[model samples]
Target: MSQWMTLFQKEVLEMWRNFKWIWVPLTFILLGVSEPLTSYYLPQIMKSVGGLPEGAIFEIPKPTAGAVLASGLSQYSTIGALVIVLGTMGIIAGERKSGVAAMILVKPVSYFSFITSKWAGSLLLVWISLFIGYISTWYYTGQLFDWVPIGEFFQSFVLYGLWLTVILTVTVFFSAALLSPGMAGFISLALALIISILSGALSNLLEWSPSQLTSYAGVLLTGGELPSDTMPAILIALLLIVILLWLSVFLFKKKELAA
Candidate 1:
């Protein structure tokens, strides 16, 4: 218990020293604020930058607040996910390369403690950064368009956040298992993309897949009628998170640390 607490504190301090606590939230806030602002001003923006031939008229339809929020989430799905991937890709691999892993392991510390501490720290960062960003998005969306229902907004956030955590967990697992941070990040991103794309293409056929979590989140945000049943996807996603974290611990325990 003492070692786990100590390692958790150390992981947090490392994040603070590295300035991740500052930049990661800032990045999310920027994305959140920018998405709504751009969506609201898109028509004016297009007109200002127009090279339309011969007095062409382009009428842009204003999007609802929920649509704006969904668009913001779409941005996070791509750019925000990439940022998280890069930020965390090195969590364990970098430690191994620097001999920090070996030093820590040489103590009486358990591998589970070491890996879970890192996971907890990374999860903290991910949740905080994403919450701040989404709150900013929700606020800006309300200001620019109609306010989304508070209950629906909260539901959307929880669902999307689960999907995001799954991605982060995959990255952490790969970071523990792989030697190269780039490879870890790449594989994690690839896996996330594949899941999303496949779920999208297959739709009802793949409704049970974890990718549907993001889709469910979008539906909640957009006030769209959800599928009659989606509990399976939610359950599957939660199961995957548990399994991946377990796999990460298992791999970390089996792998030898470099000195």
Candidate 2:
């Protein structure tokens, strides 16, 4: 336990040193604030751009707060997810490349503790950053649009966070399994895209998949009928996270032995 804590602290400090704490939150905050501001200002923005013919009566309906928040989640689904994958792609792979993993493993540290500490640290940063960004978006949303119910807002946050967790776990697993950080990130991103595409194309078959979390989140925000498969999707996402973490540890040890 002590060893895990120490390693976790090291990971946090490393993130701090690398400015993950700064930029990740800042990026999310920007994305969050932009969604509400843009939605509110779309009419004026369109008029300024003058894309329409002269005297064209272009107007946009005011978006509800729930819709605004749901759109913000979509922004996170693309740019935010990319940021997370790029930021964390090197977590384990970089350590191994720089000989840090070898040094740490040569000590009494168990592989479980080492890998779990890294995973926990990375997740802590991600969740905190997402919370900060999402809260900023929520605040602006209430100001520029109708207030989203607090209960539904929080539920959406947790569901979207779960989606991100599955994506991040895939990145971590690849980082552990591969020597090249670029390859790890590429494969992770590709896998995420594949999962998303398949989930959408076969929604009936994949109702329990993690990718459904985003849609479920949108439903929560919009106050729509909750999907009956929501709990199953959540459970499957959690299960995928666990399975990936286990694979990370196993692959990390095997790679180290091969080295």
Candidate 3:
């Protein structure tokens, strides 16, 4: 307990010194504000463009705060992929590059603490940002659209939080397996991109993948119920998080940190 606490403190220090303090907060805040703002303004812009040319066959949902918030939050599909992939890009790999891992090893910090702290810090940052963005978007959405049902929106927000945790776990796991942050970042990017593409191909077959997770959130935001059929996918997400976090520990233990 004490060791983990110490790791947490040390991790916070490292994160601050490395400039993540600015990066994480700014990213989430911007991400948060964008959703509501876009949703609020898009309808007016389209009207100025000429009100759908006097009755196109398609119907646009009345622009509301929830609509905007959902649109903005959907940006997370891209934002999240970029943020997590970059966050863990050089974690262990950087230590290997700079020879800091060896010096840290000589100190009382075990590789376990080192790896654990890195993840703990990153995860903490991710969780905080997500929560902030969630709250802000919720507030703005309500103001812009109408009365967003606070209770139901909160439900979807919490579910999105659960979804994020799983994605982060997979990213960190792959990052831990690598030799450098560059490699880790590439792998993470490849993983995210490939999965996204694959999700389209296997929408019917692989609806449980992270790719589908984003679409599911969009549906839920638009008043779709959590899919009873997706119990398997949701469970897979939980199981994968456990597996990834454990794999990160295992890989770090054998990781030839000197290499």
Candidate 4:
């Protein structure tokens, strides 16, 4: 337990050294704030561009606070996910490549402690960043539009946070299992895309998949009736996270053995 805490502290310091603690949260805050700002000022922006014909009546219906917040979540689904992948793709793979992993493992550290520490550290950073960004978006949404109910907003946050957890776990698994950071990132992104596509194409079949978490979040935000499978989807996502972490530990051990 002490070793894990030490390693986890190391991970945090590394993130700080890399400026992740600065840029990641800032990037999320910007991404979150952009949606409400754009939605509110889009007409003025259009008029400034002067692209429309003379006397053209360009009318965009004002979105509800829930819709605005949901749009912000959609941004996270794409750009936010990409940022997370890029940030974490090298956590284990880079350590191995640079001989850092072997150096650490050669000491009194157990493999489980090593892997779990990294996982916990990375998850903490990602979740904190997401929380900052989402809260900023929610604040702006309330200011520029109607206030989203606190209960519904909280529910959506949890659901989207779960989807992000799944993505981060997949990235960590590949980072531990693969030799190349680029390959790990590529495969992780590809898998996320495929899951999302599958979820959309076969909604009924994959109602329990982690990919459906984002959709369920959107429903919560918009005050729509959640599907009967919401609980199942949450359970499946948690299960997937556990399995991936376990695989990550196993693969990390194997990789070290082969070295």
Task: Give a tens-digit lDDT track for model 2, residues 1-259.
Answer: 8999999999999999999999999999999899999999999998888878877798798888889999998888899899999998999999899999999999999999999899899899889999999998999999988788888878888999999989899999999999899999999998998999999899999999899999889987887557899999999899999999999999899888887
- Provide the lowest-lDDT 10-residue window in model 1: 221-230
Query: Each model's TM-score, in the order given?
Result: 0.95, 0.98, 0.84, 0.97
Q: Model 4 clash tally? A: 0
- The list of candidate 3 runs beyond 4 A from truth reads 46-61, 257-259
Angstrom error of the Cα, residue 142, model 4: value is 0.5
Which stretch of 10 consecutive residues in model 2 shows the poorest summed lDDT?
Answer: 218-227
Better of 2 and 3 by lDDT: 2
lDDT tens per residue, model 3, 1-259: 6877787788789889988877877787788878777766766667777745556644457675555656766666678657877876777777766887677777776666777777778888887887787777777777767666776576666556666666666667776787667777777777777887898788888877755666666666676466554566677777877778777878876766434
lDDT of 4 by residue, 51-126 (tens): 7888889998888888899999998899999999999999999999999999999998988899889988889988
Question: Which residue pairs does candidate 4 place in steric collision?
Answer: none
Return the candidate ranking by TM-score, descending.
2, 4, 1, 3
Question: lDDT of each model, Cα atoms only?
Answer: 0.87, 0.91, 0.71, 0.91
TM-score of 4: 0.97
Looking at candidate 3, the ten consecutive residues that score lowest on lDDT are 51-60
lDDT of the structure predicted as candidate 2: 0.91
RMSD of each: 1.7, 1.0, 3.2, 1.1
